[model samples]
Target: MSDLPILIAGGGIGGLATAIGLAQKGVASLVLEKASRLGEIGAGIQLGPNAFHAFDTLGVGDAARAMAVYIDSLRLMDALSGEEITRIPLDEGFRTRFGNPYAVVHRGDLHGVFLKACEAHPLVSLRTASEVLDYDQDGETVTATLASGERLRGRGLIGADGLWSNIRKRVVGDGAPRVSGHTTYRSVIPVEDMPEDLRWNAATLWAGPKCHIVHYPLSGWKLFNLVVTYHNDAPEPVAGMPVTHDEVRQGFEHVSPVARQVIERGQDWKLWVLCDRDPVMDWTDGRVALLGDAAHPMLQYFAQGACMAMEDAVCLSAELAGAGDDLEPALRRYAARRRLRTARVQLQSREIGQHIYHPAGAHAALRNAIMQAKSPEDWYDAVDWLYGSTGLEGAVSREARTLGPE
Candidate 1:
């Protein structure tokens, strides 16, 4: 086998998770980050049981669990009438049924779990300000060109670079990401700033007509992560741009006082014009492969962007470890295992935004009726394909994990 390390683009959660996952399997990896520092930008992200499965596989389960703020349920509310639509209880039963607990954590904390593990591991090397521009592969080895015109060689290349990936341009050749025309605003406030009556230990979503609001406790309940989105038909991509509270309130004026108050309490709100891509079959080329947002960017409706990326890392590291010198075939196997699953997520995220979250009048009524009729068991079964499946069987640790009520 060549002594060259596998090169990974980007240094976000997915990149670090892949680096650590590879190290756990005795494979070495070099993470090339475009930024001068390695960190996460978001506030909070929901973790399905599938994310926990991936965590264990990547050897960061315990660290991740320690930092997470486990919620009791996924509460869906009608923003118009301020009524309960339905809730999926993430209690003991849910954990036992899925072999892991659903929880919410600060994005930086979760990233730290993987980053710490990667830092401690001898097989992983981290580099900042090293942007991977494109690559050249000659069967046995792949050479990556950086933005500064420097070149690096590796046995294989995995593009974990996010949404605007430089590697994807060379690998998939698909045009720019499809803009969803949805503007999302996010903020984090002290727990005290949250409405006392609304302080529930759940991942709460107030779904309305062409808009929605989500709030959950993060960072050990020290902060509340508030994310609210509206279909304003934004024409271009935007990220982390500061917006006044009044601009955000314009979209939620119709929502009930209870549902709209989240936006009122928000401080220093930032905006993100959402975007995703139509799923494509090919994300791998020879010794190069794409992971995370680079391969399958999706709307945040399903809350599985980071989770899917970690899951990809699990399958990818497993394949690479097993394949030895055959990195091309290894990447092909990795893409085969992940393609359909990621595609399902990508498509369904858009569906959820339209059908469940943003419908109005008759559509909203139909959504509420159908969703309210489901029992916890039905909800569990509906998500079994995502949280429990054969896709992660051999990759995850079978050892049962136990957690106390939060």
Candidate 2:
């Protein structure tokens, strides 16, 4: 094996997960985080069964499970009528069918799972406030130039730098990310503050015209993560901007009082104007490749962004392990395998937002009717391509099956 550690730009979940996957395959890695401290932001994220597959494969299954709040179902409500639309059970049948449980976790807790594993691995080294500005690679090695103008060389470089990735600017060169005209507000509040009548052990979504509300228990029922989004034609892209409760309430007035009450209870609300990009085929350039949002940023409607990124980590490690010292082709293969799967997610997320979550009148009726018709088995088959398998077939799946610390 090469003595040079793989240089990973960004110390977020994707980057750290990559370090763990690579370490399990007897590879060494150095994670570069632009942040002064390594941690995750945001309230909560939903994890599909596929995420569990990746977690188990990355050798953090038990640890990840320990931090997750396994919900009873994926419940949907009609915000217009305050009526139950449908629910896909996450009971024993769901777990048996998917080979893992559907769950939710605080983003920080999930990131901590990987951070702890990466910190403990002998093959993984972490750095903070060291951002990779760009890179230049020759036939044998890739050298990353940090923001401090220091150059570090490695056998390869992986960009998991997220939505505003410097590595992606050099690799894909697609320019700025597309700003979807939707605004989202997030808040985490104590469970007691959540309405007792509405509190349930489920990842619930209240869908109305041009808006939606999602909430679920987190941190062992100590907190509730509230995310409300409105399609109010927000012009520019914005992130983590603090907004008043009145601002968050602008477009949700039309929803049922039951659903509107969820938004009213939220505190310390932060706003994020949703953004995504049209999928591009190539994300690999020689020994430099992209992962996570850096590679394929998508809307949050599908709730698969992080899950897809972790899957990228699993596949990347497997491909690199299979290639031995030949790094370039391995990286290319990794991008190829991940492109279609992630792209499907990327495009579908936009569709889900437009047609499912934010539709009006007849459209809402159609969505409710179709979704209501789905049985547990029907829902299972609908997501078969995504959650039925880890979507990392052949080499990746084979590698995942051999997971263990080096």
Candidate 3:
């Protein structure tokens, strides 16, 4: 079989970035998205140093920077008293230290930047409303079948379809992800409508036992993106699409009035059940491999979900560069290099959730005291291994990895 293009499932950030990265290396890839149009929910995300590296490497850094706001400071506050406990300034020095600025952007805006980059490349093609059913490999050629019965051949497959990935089920035999007994409610409110005090060029996090709240400005300060996560004992999942403001308020009533005020102002709130998988050693099955949430689903506590996915795209393309003559070695290398790192991130994020959200009496008191006494920079230092990663460049030594498989 002649060299075929890579088939990528899912059209979110990871899938699109993978397409752009592959195209930049003169490799061909096709993106299959189940949705008729690519759009994200009304929410915001924090993009740290590692994600910036992936954006720059993929050639979308300029566009993303233009649309995103650089968060110059992050403040942690007591949810009950509404009083600041720590303030971390993120200046040029911080950027120099981290190698990239910590920025925040609307989820849709970030996805749009990646989509534009993919659209410009000749080697990248996108097919919307096309759902992939399964894939089978024959030596060098991998064939993927869509639900519509259309078949497409490719050299490899990257399942970037996210947490409910159909491809992941086929590869790992469908085990349910662990739910942490928590649910998140998210919404975007008009900045002008919010209290003027809430408008800041920083991410503000209010941490409490069994609940926490994160708020930051978006759309160039035109809107405030708010997210509230709380523990729940209910056995059933929260229902209804586009959760109403009433639902958001009810979920956070146990929180401070400041938290209540933020939720009350949200008119277009949405809810999601937070779930994640324990990292697996096996993310590859022959020519088909997993990427992003499909490969290593993580809790939102660390805010590295999208960032890790973007890093995966960059590393996968780099590993497969110029391997058109042979496919097995390159695909295996990608899987091996990514599995450990992603698994660690998944585990760390889960641990952070338990520590940050479910702290016991002493643990909670100690956490509060540390936040007040320690420099916020110290907190960032603790996560340097995560935020400072340069993907494959940091994961594997370039000079050594060039020799191919060990």
Better of 2 and 3 by lDDT: 2
TM-scores, all candidates, are: 0.96, 0.96, 0.93
Please report the candidate that would top lDDT against the real structure: 2
| TM-score, predicted candidate 3 vs. hidden true structure | 0.93
Model 3: residues >4 Å from true position, as ranges? 234-240, 358-360, 394-406
Displacement of the residue 53 alpha carbon in candidate 1, Å? 0.6
Clashing pairs in 2: none
Task: Estimate, for each residue in 239-330, the C-alpha lDDT of model 3 and write its tens digit.
Answer: 22576666666556656787557766766667877888887877788888899999998988778889989888888889878877476777
lDDT of each: 0.90, 0.91, 0.80
Per-model C-alpha RMSD: 4.5, 4.5, 3.8
Query: What is candidate 1's lDDT per residue for 1-406, written digit by digit as tens?
Result: 4688999999999899899989988899999999999999979999999999898888888899999999999999999999999988999999999999999999999989988999999999999999999999998999999999999999999999999999999998888999999999999999999999888999999999999999999999999999999999999999999999999997889999999889989999999999999988878999999999999999999999999999988888888886777888788878877887788789889999999889999999999999999999988877877888424542212311211110
lDDT of 2 by residue, 1-406 (tens): 3889999999999999999999999999999999999999898999999999999999999999999999998889999999999998999999998899999999999999999999999999999989999999987889999999999999999999999999999999999999999999999999999999889999999988889999999999999999999988889989999999999999988889988999889999999999999999889889899999999999999999999999999989988885666998888888777887787789889988988788888888998898988899988877877885564772434434333321
Q: Tell me model 2's lDDT, rounded to 2 decimals.
A: 0.91
Residue pairs with clashing backbones, model 1:
none
